[model samples]
Target: MLQIDLWKRVLIWALVLCGLALAMPNLFYSRVETHNDAVKAIAASGGVASPDQTAEAAEWPSFLPSGLVNLGLDLRGGAHLLAEVQVSDVYADRMDGLWPEVRDTLRAERATIGTIRRVDSAPDELRVQVGEPAQIAQAVALVRDLARPIVSLTGVGASDIDVSAEGADVVVRLSEAEKQATDTRTMQQSLEIIRRRVDEVGTREPTIQRQGEDRVLIQVPGIGSADELKELIGTTARLTFQPVVGRTTDGSADPGARNLLLPSLDNPGEYYIIEDRTVVSGEELTDAQPAFDQNGRPAVNFRFNPAGARKFGTYTAENIGSPFAIVLDSEVISAPVIQSHIAGGSGIITGNFDVEESTQLAVLLRAGALPAKMTFLEERTIGPELGADSIAAGKIACIVAFSAVLIFMALSYGFFGMVANLALIINVGLIFGLLSLIGATLTLPGIAGIVLTIGMAVDANVLVYERIREELKTSKGPARAIELGYERALSAILDANVTTFIIATILFIMGSGPVRGFAVTLALGILTSVFTSIYLTRLFIVMWFERRRPKTIEV
Candidate 1:
């Protein structure tokens, strides 16, 4: 009478087989990884496979599951960087953008203010000198009118900029509340841009997270070095098209008002004096691709959105025959003369760039520019050898713990313990299988969690075996004792594992990085262990009991 139904038995075996099959790829980790990469590369290349990729893809069969547990930084080796975003740079950019609006506003009130000119001030401050000192109040009032209400919750109803008269000049600066909002937005944007850039390289399990107020922590598991990562992310790649005022050989040439002198990228010592006001910024770009120019030279082609297209078309049409400077990261890449009206918002950037440079530029353009500059605070390149050592140590610890648990269970509970030990093995396989299915990164702490799980996995079997022994002492038959053992132990097993599962969930939600990795494995181990102990182990016992038809048994 102690028996599992046909459907339940089938389900248990099915789950076990599925778990083992999914976890099989890890046995040949490098081969499967290579095959997966080759497949992905072929897919990315529009299904056109190279000879090497084809050979690599053939290493693994197409019918089998290919998922493998992603190794974490502690297991894989990588780059780590702590970067401090120069948030105040955003304030400078905001002020520079505000100047055009402020100039246009004051020009409309020229009758009273006479004339207005941007004067020297802090990078974060916009100071305008009013020709008519008597009308300074009117100038301040006009500038203040340009201030829009901050859209953030904390800064609701507060103006974005603070305006006041500094002697004869009206001084404008971002308000404290607006600065706080900008800092938050800047950090978020930086994080996103960094993530996109890292993802573009097709690396695995990169950690890009915000630290304190303006710091970002980036841990890339497969990058060569921190310097390499810094290079990939540090370049702002801020592309802008601006009206070129004139070309100059002098680096320190005065570009007059509202103009910038930027060095040409292709020609050393030559500079382009361009309007600081952007005709079209890279933020409006929707697509960028590396392609060959008319002369077969490597170049980048870019297409802008509708609004950007309209503005670009209007600017080019109105300024035909004048040169427009294509600026990247404060340097002029090229100053091409516009012979006629160029519409459609599509253009080419031709410079002294090779194929790799063009491709990298395209990637950066597609990813968008960082909102502010970042200063690297801490940088480290974890070597693969060290990671291998950690992995080896973790493996030894898990094996020792696993063997000890298996031996203890077998010695203490005898034949019943062997069944539980088998279930424990399946439980671990299920954990790895689940991790693979979800593409979870396994850290050293995650391995520790698995080891801890192995020890705890036998608790349910212990309770059931003790109950059976007690029932047998009360003169109950073997079949009846086994049934009562599982039935009575079910509540205790659920209560204990349920509480542990809740704690694991809380840790996952509240923790990050390695802590979250531990939580994930711990939570998964709980589920799998519970299934194996209560269901799989019971099925094994019931099958053995039904076949043997024993009169008496020892737990």
Candidate 2:
């Protein structure tokens, strides 16, 4: 009556062994983590590992599972920042770029519109005043023709730009559909750039996610402070090459409508008036690195893509003796005269830069520019000492709960209680094993979930033991009593755990951060508890029954 099939027996033992094996790595977490990092470094470096790294990797066997549960920001201490992207900034930039196009289109219809002049308006609005009011309709129609349909699922057939006329002035702005599309793309690009910048520092698992339409939440574990992280991502890094018109000491110089007056990076009070039209943009850069100039000064070397190279080469060849300004975020970094017809798409940017500035500049150039400026709304730093205290407290709570549950089970049903205790222990191991295998982050709340699980795990064993006691009073054989006990308890165990598991699943799907962590451990605990109680405990009981051959015994 208490017999288990060979396949079932083997399966039970296999699962137990695998769980133990997986959980073993957590006991040697530091060693395993070091091994894992070394392996990753070596792989990233194309198998060229340092002697120390090779030694560290060799300390842990290659055959063993090296996965470890990642510690959360709360437990590892990190920087947290919530930034809001200024999506409207991109709108202004887009409008500024459209000026050249709008001017060209209106000039083609110069006979109708008369004189067309750009007027100052809101940052998001593009206003153009025409001398001839009668031709306003023609001007609006021409501007509207430039509008392309928004390329998005929700905004299909909607125009990218909206053109309207108020008397002789034509007003243009990005349509609502285009704004939505631009916001989505901007947020996605911001997230990617932020991730790349953070990853470049080699910080472990960082949580960089979009909070809402314009906000991004960044949490980097093991980071010193929020300021450090902000410094890394806050730079706009907008690099442009413009034809320089003249240099002046006047900060308030009006450099005409088509020119921009930008301050020099090295020289205070010096400004350079440069043409607004860009010869080359940083977006066309394929690679950038920190290197030394011909004079051995720290500088940033850059290589342009083919299209950028062609444009830059042609511009340089045409304006051989004229100075071109290298502008970074509206600051004139340099205005070097074209010495000769420079070709091949390669150039060096030399400023009054030290080694550190050059390196940071290089990193920013390589990561690409943010689509929009970000204003940090919230910033926080978690200290490692606090995390240590939390971990210590969590460990104490777990040990206390575990000891209490084990003692209660032992006192209630004697030998059967001991069997339940063994299963409970294995269940805990299985929970850790599964967590490690899946690389789930464990938080303080997750520790609480495991503690709660320890108390709940004994419920199945109690049900079986009580049922067995009742069957024994009815004069059923010990083996037969035990068999019926498990059979009767199966439905109750499944129903109760399934309902709880469903709740845990819902929590996991809907919840974020710590709540998800709790749900993970809770769900895993439920599964492991069921397996150990039904199969593992029964196996032990069956083995005992066969060995003793007792006619009557206590559960």
Candidate 3:
């Protein structure tokens, strides 16, 4: 009788929680039912296609993504990649591959550059030492065109490796500021490239970022082909256009070409001459989409920016029927002749291509060309062999853990033990409901969190059972003892659940990925256990006592 009032209160609490569970699908979520109906209708044979006209489809707009907890990468197999960036290529491009050319031109002038070699590491910077034996002043004066870092200046006979070139060579030797900048730029460029490649191949929601300076971090949510991805992403498809060498000044085209030349549109073959400029650049193109031309041949449709359009219009206007090479990575794709003025800034490129070849070309062109070419630094892959084994091991561990807890509760408290186990099952249900409601991701460690919960959930039942036995020792009636049991155990149960909850909350805040998963399951279990133990188990106890009203109680 002393604890009957408390039992009533906890029974009411359970009822209230049941009501909250009913409202959860609407409170935290809305319109899920409508979306499901619409998707079902769409799957049917005579479904309405219009989202507006279809009653079911009209409700599709309010639907949220399934906010269910997803098993994480460790439980589910996926690929992870770490890559390094090489930025020395940027400086090398800036030099325009003229190290040997510049050296030869200087030598022809009879300038005695003492020593000439490209920096072994930087490779972009050429170190030149002048003076027959070592005349630094003479060397500097002779090579005024070359930028200076006259490392060992010579007045008359100063002979000590006078490395006078762009200080970029010395920058490599210093190895702090220069290396950092190179690493930063390389990572930035590589991230951009990787993101594009991921998009091209239809990999969804990829995360690409600079990890430190030289390394790139890439996370792809649902991609499978690690090897294919590595090959695609690692290719630094750098494209370049070198002005084709030919025809001279004085209104003269190459022999058998004067008829092909016409007046330029912007240049009029005059001031600001189109002839001075390279005909086309990849930078001008906005997008390249695969398509078939009027003749049913595979082609890539291209759109150019206003400036590129003007450059292109003038080139086509001047060289009415002359062919221009479309070079990709120095290999010519097509050297199509100018057919029309192409004034609208959009046109198509036709070649001997099939649909697949044409589509890939368009994808690459849309991704944009890399600034500098790259070589593959490294590659690694994880096979599914190990992940499958881990899944099996985790399943066995969960079954053993659940069995242990179930037996312990049944042996420890007779009929009350059975009720506690029933409450535990409902407790697990609430955890899943909460997870589905909140979109938390599940993981391997999360399975541990749930398994640990089985043993812990029995603690409240043990507290109540022990309290009943103590009251019974005083020769109290079974009903009176049961009521007193709940009353005495309430404070300790609250305090224990509250403390565990705080720890789980803290874990959720501080951890990432699998750790966060563990926190989620642990925290949710604390809440559900509190509900089921106090309310569901209490309801069973109250009914059991009211019906049996036994003269003697068995512990």
Best by lDDT: 1
- Worst window of 10 by summed lDDT in candidate 1: 41-50
Lowest summed lDDT over 10 consecutive residues: which window, candidate 2?
A: 40-49
RMSD over all Cα atoms, model 3? 11.1
Q: How should the candidates be ordered by lDDT, best one leading?
A: 1, 2, 3
Score every model by TM-score: 0.92, 0.83, 0.55
How far does residue 478 in candidate 2 sit from its true spot (Å)?
2.3
Tens-place lDDT digits, model 3, residues 398-468: 78887787788889888888899888876765676677667565667887888877767888888888998
Top candidate on TM-score is: 1
Q: List the residue pairs that clash in candidate 1.
A: none
Which pairs clash inside model 3?
A: 3-483, 114-129, 114-130, 115-129
Q: Tell me the deviation in Å of residue 31 in model 3.
A: 24
The C-alpha lDDT values of all candidates are 0.92, 0.90, 0.62
lDDT of 1 by residue, 397-438 (tens): 988988888899989989998999889888998999999999
Q: What C-alpha RMSD separates each model from the true structure?
A: 2.6, 4.3, 11.1
lDDT of 2 at 41: 73
Question: Which parts of model 3 are misplaced by more than 4 Å?
Answer: 1-82, 91-121, 124-178, 188-196, 199-213, 216-225, 239-328, 334-381, 413-443, 453-555
